[model samples]
Target: MPTERRIGPARERDRLADAREDERAHAVIRNVRAARMVAGRADSAEECSLLLEMLGLEPAAERR
Candidate 1:
């Protein structure tokens, strides 16, 4: 059998990072919310390219 690797984001869209009762759990949850907020703000591929450039990443190659 050949080993395989995932090429994109994980299938589990949401997950908890800590025990439900842990005080730090709120911070973890907040980080997820912040990520979603940024993802929601990008309305187009061009916007995503700009965001990546701001983060100092090269724009991904165009897909066929």
Candidate 2:
């Protein structure tokens, strides 16, 4: 009976973690789509690169 009780909460934690992961994945997809739209509207190569960096779609250069 005691072992059964512990198992229930463990299962619940796993389920909650899965739900949170799903939510995070969806958010990343939305951000990528928005970044792509902004990139499309960008006027020049430099402007598009800056916009993508701002949206975190591209990694910024390291400062010396």
Write candidate 1's Cα lDDT for 1-64 as tens digits. 7689654444333233234446577766765565455557889877866775675455434569
Q: After superposition, how far is residue 54 of candidate 1 from its true place, in Å?
A: 8.5
Specify the highest-TM-score model's number: 2
Candidate 1 vs. true structure, TM-score? 0.34
Compared with the true structure, all predictions reach lDDT values of: 0.58, 0.79
| Global lDDT of model 1 | 0.58
lDDT string for model 2 (1-64, tens) is: 4555455888999999999999999988887788778767999879988888877786334559
Model 2 stretches astray by more than 4 angstroms: 1-7, 59-64
Give the 10-residue window scoring lowest on summed lDDT in candidate 1: 9-18
